[model samples]
Target: MILHILDEEKFLKKAIQIFNDILPKDNVYLIGVNNKKSEIFHERIQLDNMFYVETGSSRYKRVFQEYAERADIIFFHNLYKSYKLNLYSLIPNNTKNVWYLWGAEIYGLNPRINNILPLTQKAYNSNLPLLKLLRKRVLSKIKKNYEWHLFKKILTNKIDYVLTNISEDIDLLESYIPNGTSKGWFTYFSFSEQNFEDRIVLKRNNILIGNSSSETNNHIDTFELIRGKDISQRKVYVPLSYGDEEYKRVVISEGRRLFKDKMVPLTEFLHLDEYNSIINGCSILIMNHKRQQAFNTIMMAIAAGCKVFLRDENTIYSCLKREGFLVFSVQKDFGGEDAMNPLTEKEMLRNISLCQQLYKYSTVKSRIKQQILSILDEQDKT
Candidate 1:
C-alpha cells in the first residue's frame, strides 16, 4: 500500500486521477485536499482527487495517520511543509519515503533570484505586494531556522529517494540537505498522454511568452528581451490565469506598456481544446523560467512544431538539448539578429517526430509504471 502526502495544486488532481487509473486498484491517492475548502474546487464534492474528506483537520490527521501506518511507502509531494512535516518522528523507519521534487519546493524554498534578468527581477521586487513581501520574508527565515533544525535529519535518515527527471534539482537540493536522498527520474511530464490531433502544427509567427504571472516566468523581462525584435506580425500571448495576482497586474501593465497592441494577457483559464488551438497557431514558445517550470507547455510547443527557447541557467535546458530537443538558450540564442525566426522545416519535422515517439501515451504509461514498480520491487526485495 502507498500514501501520498500531497500539496493542493490543480494539476496534481488530474495527474493523480490518471495515476490511480494506471496503477493497480485504488492504492495511489491524491491526499490532503478538502474539496470544499480548496481554492481550485469549491463545494463538498466527492471528486476522485482525495480519498478521505473531513471538515475537521483533526479528523484529517487521524485519517492520514491511519493510511500512513498501512503504507509500505510514503511520498512527500513537493516538500511544501518539509521541515514542518515531522518526517522523522511520524513514519515508520522501515517505510520508504520519496520526495517527488516539484521545482517550486526547491526554488520556492531557496530561490536564485539573481539568475533572473535584471528588468524582470526589478519589476517583480518593485511590484510585489507588501503582504506577500512580508510573507516571503517570514518563509525565508523559516527556511534558515529549519537548516539548523530537523531538515538534515529528515532528509538523510527518513527520505530514501528523490524522484524527479532533473538531477540538477537533486544537486541544488543537496546544497540544502547534503548527502541526503538518492535521486531518480520520474516522467511526470512525458508527452505520452497527449492526443495526436491536438498538435496542429503550422508555419506560425505568433509567440507565447511564459506559462504564468509568477515572477519566475519573467514576463516583464521577456517584454524587454523582445523589445525591438522584428515581431510586428507576431502577437505575444502570456498566460496569467494563476500565480500571484499582484504580479499578474505588474506583468500585464509592463507587457502592454512595451508591446501595446501585440500583448495579449490570458487572464482567464481556457479549455484544453482552446489552449491547443492557440499553441497550434504559434510558431514560437519562449519560456524564460530560471528553473524547470512550464514543462507541459514547452513539450506541447515541441509537438506543435514551435521553436522553444529556455534560459541556459535552467538545468532542463541542457537536459532537453542532450535528450535531442531543439531547445535554444535565451541568454545566448535570443537577443540576436535572427531571434524571431521559427524552427526550419527539417528541425520542426524532427521535433514533431521525436515528440510523438518519445512522449506518446504508451511511452508515458510505461515510464510511470516502471518508476512505480521499481520502488515496489525494492520493497519486495527488502
Candidate 2:
C-alpha cells in the first residue's frame, strides 16, 4: 500500500484528486499533518480517504508507528520538519521513502551567503525598525540552519526517490543526496496544455510583474527596471496572494507610486479558472525571481500565448530556451524590441505550438503517472 504524508492545504486538494483518480482507494492511504494554517483546510476538505492528525499528538505518533510497517511506500510532500511530527521516528527503514521536491524545499536548502542576513539589501531593504530587522535576521538564520541539519540527518540519507524536473534542483539533489537515492523528473502540477485551435495571441503591451510578495521575486528590482517607462495607459498586474505581508504592503506602495491608477495588486486569493481568465487579457509577463517561483503561473502565461520575460540567469529561462520555447531575457533589451510591440500571427502560432508540446495537461498527467509506475517498477526489481 502507498501512504502519503501531506500538509493540509487547499492547493494540495487538486494534487490529492489526481492521486485518488490514479490509485485505488484501498491501495492508497492519505495522512495530513496539522499545522498553523491547516485547520481551515481540514474543515473544508472532508474526505473518507484522508485522516487528519496533529503531529505533536501521541495518537499521531502511534498512527505513524502502525503505518510505518503496513505501508509499502511512504511519500513525503516536502521535508519540512514542523512541530506537527517527528520525521525520523515516522519514516521506516523497511519501506521505500519518496520525497516530492516542491520548489521551496529545494530553493531554501542552499540559500546564498549574501541572502543569509535578512537585513541584507538583497532580501529585505524595507523601512522596518533596526532592532526588529536584526532580530528577524538572527531568527531566520537559526531556523534555516536547523532545518538544514534535520534535512541532512532525516531525509538526505534515507529517501529512495526524489521527484523533480528543474535542472538546478537536480544538481542540488545530486550534490546532497546519498548513493542509491534515485531521481526522477516529475514536476508538481506545473504543466498545463494549450488548445492550438482558435488561439488568440495577446499583444505584448500590458505588463504583469512578479508572482508573489516573496523576496525572491525581486519586486524592487523589477519595479526599478520599468520605472522610467511611460505606462500611463497600460495596466500592470502584480499577484501578491500569499507571502510576506510587509513585503506585499511595500510592493503595493511602490507600485502605486510608480504607476498610480494603472497599478493593480492582486492581494486576494483567486481560483485557478478566474486567474487564468485574467491571464488571457495580459500580454507581457515579467518575472524577476532570483529563484524558481511562479513556475505554474509562468507556464499558464506561455500557454495563453503571452510573451514571457525572465532573467537568463534563471534555470527556467535556460531550460525553456533549450526546449525551443521563445522566451526573452529581461537583462537584454530583446534586440531593442519594445514591450508594447504586438506579435505577428506566425510568432503567436509558434508560441501556441510550443506551449501545447511542453505544458499540456494531458502530457503532464501521463508523465506523472509514468514516473510513479517507474519508481514502483524499480522497487519491484530491487
Off by over 4 Å in 2: 26-35, 38-43, 55-59, 81-85, 111-123, 176-180, 190-196, 199-204, 340-342
TM-score of each: 0.87, 0.88
Q: Taking the tens digit of each residue's C-alpha lDDT, what string does model 1 give over 203-272?
A: 6889998987788888777787888787799899998988778889889898898889899999877877
User: Which residue pairs come into collision in candidate 2?
Assistant: 55-84, 192-359, 193-360, 193-361
Q: For residues 84-178, write the lDDT of model 2, one tens digit per residue.
A: 22567567777778877775655675444232223225435566567868876788778777776677666556788877667666665556644
Question: lDDT of each prediction vs. the true structure?
Answer: 0.73, 0.69
